[model samples]
Target: MSGRLSGKRIIITGAIGNIGKEAVRSFVAEGARVVIGDIDEHAGRAVVAEFGGATHFVKVDVSSEASVASLLAQGVEWLNGLDVLAQNAGLQRSGPITGFSQTDWDALFAVNARAHFFGAKHAVAHLKRSGTGSIINMSSLAGKRGGPGLVAYSASKGAVVAFTTALAMELAPDNIRVNAICPGWVDTAFNQPAIDFMGGANVQQQKIAALVPLGRQARAAEIAPLFVYLASDESAYVTAQSFGIDGGVYNG
Candidate 1:
């Protein structure tokens, strides 16, 4: 840990999720105080306990505006103020368009796309107060290039990309940097649902090997550093950008 984020205060939603858990570890190791916000109370508490200090867990259902607001309010109370917000809570429902139910579509967007907007809308004030703040939205490679069986999930993530771009311009004058990360195939349990939809774990990996130029999936640890960099002063000049960390899957 280089203390790159020393004295910073952060709130990471979906803290119990695969990618969110890695972000928590990376941020804390770099000396940031983080509030782990997630619906999974047990996992969130476990991370806080492991981190020992400078880490707090608050249960949050990002899909609700009230829940998002509460997370920010409680997080700010614990950390004194907010410096960064990682809108990482997301869900995916797979199926072809013809069979995609409205329930699935709404649920997917509620957490994936809608949550990003609410998370930022609630945190912007606290962020602006920091003088310079950062918001990292977790998108996906599926969003950039549509996935065959991920119609609902792909559309929801694509919404996040557009939301990030629009919100960046709106928040630029306040020194709040907004960026999105499009990850290809990161090894995490979160991929289990998609894998099951694609046939099975073996089939999924085979497909990834053929699709991803890297020929292998990335570990969660490999994706955590980008969150640190984007949230730290190291990327001060970087804003309004959608970074692809997808094993060379998306060139644009």
Candidate 2:
């Protein structure tokens, strides 16, 4: 690691899971001290232990605005301030529009879409104090191009893209950057919903081969670097962009 993030203080939500875990490792490796926020206390504590002193964990339910506010309050205090916020927590529910209950739809928006807003809403004060800061929201390729069975999930993630764009402009004057990462099929248990909707792992693989130009799913490690880049000063001039790491699924 080149210590690209040396002296940076970061807060990452969903740090117990695949992509979030990998991003935490990458951030720490690049020399950032991080506070992890998640709902699972057991897994969050284990991650803190795994990372030693460079990381701390704060229990949070991203879907709750109060929970998110508390997470940021505690996290910023722990880190002594804040420089980056990675809103990586999300929920996915897939089914036909007719069959998708309103309950699931609301749940999806609460976590996938509204959570980003909640996080940014609370994180802005701490970030502004840093003079320059970054916010990375995780969107998806489904958000960019709505798929057959992903109406709700896609709608929620699409909201993220719009949020990122508008927030970037609003925060740019504060030297705060906002961006979205729209990834395609990354190989993680996180994809189980889509896989089940596709029938099974085998069918998902077949579909990936047909849809992705790279003919495979990306690994979590492959996606973490993008998080690191956005969080670091390397992206000082980058903002308001929804970057696609979808293996050429959508060129636009």
Candidate 3:
């Protein structure tokens, strides 16, 4: 009956999304109290409400300093301290450079890249006070390799990976570990349009699954434990590294 995250207080940004929602469940099931922050108030409340009063939900636009500040404050107030900060909010858009609008690029980066920056910045204060906290940033495989239509997402994820390394080094002295998880081809509804446009449901899925040596996309639940490991003493000495939960796509 040992709980890996017993008594831990975690704040997961973008907690309303598919993978984020699943992570919430994992964190809770492992005995951690979670505070969720996301732009989707309805989904965020609904999801957290499913767990009832045990979890806290906040409306946060990670791109906004005030929103990030408010969310962190609420989390700190509710949990008394913070142990894990999972920066998991992001968005993806497709358009070639020649046809891509600069506005689109800015908008996407605000949520996908800049939001990570702000979330970590604000969460750091409470985490540092909690002593020996862990920071896990959500990255994507697109950041590792270039794709024709995925420039913005790829670049943003690349930025997140780099940020993880640099932050890890800077925060190591505080015993605060920082890491990144780059997920690949998750079979969630997030990419449904791309899958559907590419072909029928089964065919599209098969094609994507074929890319990974494992012959399938990932599940959010599958990725959550990595965060738990990174957040726990089991990985006490692990930091500044990026682990790919990408179905052997990166072969790491």
Best by the TM-score measure:
2
Candidate 1 C-alpha lDDT tens digits along 1-252: 689999999999988867888889999999999999999899889989988788998998988999999999999999999999998888867888898899999999999999998999999999988899999999998888887789889999999999999999999999999999888888888887788889998898899889889899999889899999999999999998889888998886
State the lDDT of candidate 3 residue by residue for 176-220, as single tens digits: 999998888886777663454455578766776677788888878
Q: lDDT of model 3 at residue 250?
A: 86
**Tens-digit lDDT string for candidate 2 (1-252):** 799999999999988889999999999999999999999999999999999999999999999999999999999999999999999998988889989999999999999999999999999999999999999999999889998889999999999999999999999999999999999999899889888988999999888899899999989999999999999999999999999998999998
**Candidate 2 displacement at residue 13 in angstroms:** 0.5
Weakest lDDT window of 10 consecutive positions for candidate 3: 191-200
lDDT of each: 0.91, 0.95, 0.83
Off by over 4 Å in 3: 196-203
Query: Candidate 2, which segments miss by more than 4 Å at Cα?
Result: none
Q: What is the lDDT of residue 115 in candidate 2?
A: 97
Better of 1 and 3 by lDDT: 1
Question: How displaced is residue 180 in candidate 1, in Å?
Answer: 0.7
TM-score of decoy 2:
0.99
